[model samples]
Target: MREDDWLAARFEENRDHLRAVAYRMLGSQQEAEDAVQESWIRLSRSDPASIDNLGGWLTTVVGRICLDMLRLRRSRPEQAVGEHSPVLADHEVPDPELEAVQADSVGLALLVVLETLTPAERLAFVLHDMFAMPFDDIAPIVGRSPAAARQLASRARRRVQGNPDIPEADSSRQREIVSAFLAASRSGDFEALLEMLDPEVVVRADEAVAARGAASLVRGAAAVAEHFSGRALAARLALVDGLAGAVWAHRGVPQVVFAFTISEGRIAEIEMLGDDDYLEQAELTIIEK
Candidate 1:
């Protein structure tokens, strides 16, 4: 095949993985698409023969583009935060059968945790932790020394481990938490709800379109119980990204799907995808209201 044809085929084959990386980095499917498209443009103009590891090279290109995007957009409202907080907290719809060794790495909560790091830190950590890219390979990707990359990964690890967020788990365990959350909400049992959450829990929605950050970031079990005493049932629960979360149904129509990040068994972070326009890109369904 001609070089261009070969590049095209490779791009097609790697599109999904490329987009996943971009999306996780930037937290906006539109932004990720833009980054990937830009990478393709660069790829089309380059000589393929000089490339040794096309997959790794393409991923680097996309990662760099995303990093630049993150940098350039730093002044905008969407300036990369410690996380991509969506206005609608409960709208994630992930493919149940998607197979991959790192499927659990892309949780909304985890992504938010990723947001806390600087661009270089995020890149270094993701390449080393999520993809298992060697520190030597990761150094050039972030324009840091191999030692620096290693340090960045180490720092990122410390932050993640220190923060009391629950590590992502299998589907059955996910269902257990979801079920417990849902049951607590539906049964009007505040004590049961308290038992399901961790002590230092926070409930925040995206400020881009959200009006509130936790109604109350209660400290202990009793405080959590007090907060949920009469308010739990007002919200509706749905399975998002294979975890239990809330979906706001307006006028009997699903308007937003929110996803939560659980840590230490409590809600550590909450993200909502309220931009209805971006729902389709995320493969999510938005009902009426």
Candidate 2:
């Protein structure tokens, strides 16, 4: 067999693991695929005979590329005109324990939490805590001293604990609560909705001009019910990121989607991403009934 063929075979064998690693670092599947593709291109240009451990080499290349992408993205200014935001997808995720050792961070909620962390802290924590890489190896990934990498990871740990975005709830219970929420929405039972909702709740619909910010929150069960009143919303229930959510369509076009974060059997937060951008990412087609 040709030397190029041999190198291609080795790369194909480790592509899945590489994709998983890149996905965790980049937070988007499309970008992750891009990182993996770039890594392979870099690998192809090098003499395969010189590389001893192909898997490790590929991972290091991908990790460094991802770090560069993150830094460049941070440095760029926000778009003054309409911007195209990458829509996040909800898929049938793998078991976290199985992927944890390999550094495949699976949950969307966890990814959102990671966004609060600095780029250096994220690299250190993902490398050391998720991938089991030592500080010595991670220091180079972030271009910091070994002691600095350790401190970065430590600081990240504290920030993650300080203001966690979501709370831990049993998966089964969360599903059940989501099911109840769907039933209530379909029936328009305000009492059931109130019972399921926590006294302090927040709802932010992406289509609303306010879109985001603390001031946009809809507090209290009464306010929650009032907001839903007089709306002609037709939705179907689905499991998104192992949590309950709804897909609302009007005139055969998907207009809104709502994903809830439940805690202690009450819905604590409701995140509504109503942009049609989700239609392409989720591959959803709204049909008129």
- Give the best candidate by TM-score: 1
Question: What is candidate 2's lDDT per residue for 105-220, written digit by digit as tens?
Answer: 44555666666677777778777777777877777888766545765776676566664222445656776776677667666788878898889988865433245332356888
Q: Provide backbone clash counts, one per model.
A: 19, 0
Which candidate tops lDDT? 2
Per-model TM values vs. the true structure: 0.49, 0.48
CA RMSD (A), model 2:
18.4
State the C-alpha lDDT per candidate. 0.64, 0.67
lDDT of 1 at 251: 75
Candidate 1 clashes: the total is: 19
